[model samples]
Target: MNYRTNPKNGDKISQLGYGCMRFPSSATAGVSDIAEVKRLIKTAFDGGVNYFDTAFVYGDSEKVLGEVLEDLGIRDKILLSTKMPQFSCKSGADFETYFKKQLAALRVDYVDYLFIHNVSEKKRWDELKSWGILDWIQEKLDKGQAKNVGFSCHGSTSEFKAILDDHDWDFIMLQYNYLDENWQVGREGLKYAADKGVPVFIMEPVRGGLLADKLPPKAKTAFDNLPTKRSYASNAIRWVLDQPEVTMVLSGMSAFEQVTDNLTTASEINAGGLTDNERSAYVAAAAAIREFMDVYCTACGYCLPCPKGVSIPDCFYYYNLSFIDDMASVKRNFAGFVGNGNISACVGCKACERHCPQSISIAEKIAAARTRFGL
Candidate 1:
């Protein structure tokens, strides 16, 4: 378990923090299997993992973590990181209400690292502040209920910059992976936060399981030629660790095998870990994957000022994924754009395509989305 110093508060954090979102299901239904969750956490701790990240909505994860850690008698041995759901702030008083509930759920009096959960859109933070939730958090911090204050963001770089300037945070979590280097905050946002002295913790280091599947036939040859040895997952994880701006990379491990595999890579690796040539192999591989996605849609939303309220980039992203690959994220991404005046509302207007520099033929893509996602 290699560790890095939190730039703001200087607390050492393990580079491979355990995310508790995907604990194995109990009935093979939806409920998380506590016994398996416990074993995985125990194995992680025994193997030197010290960061345990959970949230209120991860379906009994807080309770499972609390029980496991208490049974192991290692409450103080690891960092207890959880989030306060921003949407829970109905009033200033609800802050304490929700925070206390989280404490009870986790069976802990104080959280080592607490964040404003999932600040994906700029409106999320604003809505919370309108209800005085930020003030409530500060009060809790002053009262020692939360040791460190921060947020986990999925918003754009500009929004993240504003949030960094708006508050003094001990750490910040962002969705960073090999594929998303140019996505939100991408490389620039990461450096911006690091320069401001905020320790950056990374989530979704593998693009939410997009990189772990059997390599495409074209790319398998390149991976097979590697010298030192690596799996597709290991190489992807190593790429994130290679970046200097990232303090820790969080992996949501549901299986003991995953825990074992990740621990081996994380324990042996460090900053400046990958060689120049090896790094090139990964970059080349990622390029090949992008070559599979020839759309060149940066997802910049330049085509979004759609008059018909259609989600243009979103429609294309899902359409491509559903037809071209079996990745689960495609369906997940599609679901979000289904309601409202989404792709189904395209109305065959080529106005958006006219504005698109990529000349993507927006109406055609929307028709494709209708067929692909059953819209």
Candidate 2:
């Protein structure tokens, strides 16, 4: 497997990091199955994957990871990364409370990588400081409780730049995919971090399984003509790994089959792996997927003064879910989305569409969604 040097310590981190959020469910129906989770961990290690990522909010992931590591006696062999839930804390003292709890949950004395979970806006930055966030973190680093300090962001490029410029971070993580290269924290942010000599870790490389499935008919045809045998999921993964700046790409694999498939793909992937023809095919496929979009709102919130309590961007997101070639599980999410807001409330006002960057026919898209979903 390809490995990249951690900018701070020069440690060789695997390109494919295992995200433990997808571990098999236990009797709690959402909690991870300890035995199966351990097996998956062992399998990943055997396949040359050494970076494991988990978080406090990922459905008891820390506890499961701790149990599995202790049971298997391989905790030292793997690099453990987890996050602090700053949102759950009301005061600066609460930071230490949660940190101690997480250490016990993971049964680890120190974390190799620890991040302030999901800082997406300036408001969160204000909150972090008001609560002495940096001071508490510096204490952990000085005390050797955390090997590195980092953050995972789901904000815009401008906001991300502000964060990057504001701190002397060890590393930074962001959501990046072929589709999101120009979306949240786009290509500009990716390159900026790389230029600053910061190793970037990528999350949502598959766009939350959207690219893995729901390929447009034209896009599916592109994959079908490919000479190499691989799934749509691996294609998306390979695209991320092709970038030289990305230190590690995190994949949330849910089942044993998924875990096995991802491990195989990760070990086989290399930088500059895709040929010119294959690169063109993937780009063409992405364009075809974009054509299926009914609206171009961009979720910028420019037109938010709705007379009715309708969330336009969320409405569009759910609307897109219903148009998938095979509904399967997405249909349920679509149904729930409409139950929250109806298209009938749009009032046919041109105000929203006027400010839309993509110039999408907002009223038309909502009307279509209403009729199509039988809402």
Candidate 3:
């Protein structure tokens, strides 16, 4: 696989890092299939993907990754990266508590990359600082428990800049995709971090599977007209890798096919790999997708576990899909997905909106879904 060197520490991170957030789940229940998870991880490792990213809040991701890598006896063969659930930290000691648990979960003594997760606002950063997060990180480094310290951001470009300037970050992660070139830290934040010699890792390169599947008809036509036919997913990923500043692109592959496709793309592509014609195709496809989208939700699921039991992301997904695909099929699937918690159950609590990184008017969107679907 193609690899890029992190300027800060000279670590050769794979161009395609395996994101462990969305492991395959059994159809009977939401439980992850451990055997399938192991197979996917083994495939990625055997394919030369060294970076495996997980987090505490990813619903047993860390534990499962730890178990799989250990069973495969390839923990040392890969770089283990995980995050501190900053939102769950109430005190300084909690940092150590959570980190120790992470280490234990991974069954590893040290992490290759440890990040303060989702440092989206200055207020959160300041709170973390007050809790002695910097010292805690230094302690981890000194003890060789964490090789690198960094953060993932989901805030305004100004807040992103402030956070970058506030600390000596070894790396930075952000939600970057062709559709979000001017959104949330965007190209400007990317360049800002790169200029300061900080390597950047990209998350949501496909906007949580939105770009890969459910393509707008116009967008699919744009790609279909291209001389070299590629999956919409490949186009989205290549668009990100076209930038020289991106150190790695993380894809949360839930299926074996996705793992295989991403591995091939990562191995063949390089910095500025896209040709002029290919770039034009992406530009056209992105425009069409944007024109077709109603909510712009990435389906990241951050605004989840709604107090009112509403499936906010599902509501938005079906609403958007209704426009691009057959409305009857979309509605049928939406019925099963929503089950008892339809959009009409929304109570206007605005709790989901508070956590949404996109700052989408989630309650308003739910209302729109009810109207569009005649729920």
* 287-328: candidate 2 lDDT, tens digit per residue: 887877665444534455566756777677666755645554
As a whole number from 0 to 100, the lDDT of residue 110 in candidate 3 is 97
Q: Give the TM-score of each candidate.
A: 0.79, 0.83, 0.97
Q: In what order do the candidates fall by TM-score, top score first?
A: 3, 2, 1
Ranking by lDDT: 3, 2, 1
Write the residue-wise lDDT of candidate 3 on 1-375 in tens digits. Answer: 999998988988899999999999866465778999999999998899999999988988888888999899998888899998988889998999999999999999999999999999988899989989999999999999999999999899999999999999989999999889999999999999999999999999999788886788888888788888778898889899989999999999999999899998998889978888887877898898887688989888888889887878878878999888888888889888775356878988898888899999998888888888887
Looking at model 3, residue 30 earns an lDDT score of: 58
State each model's CA lDDT, in order.
0.77, 0.80, 0.90
Best by lDDT: 3
Candidate 3 regions off by >4 Å? Answer: none
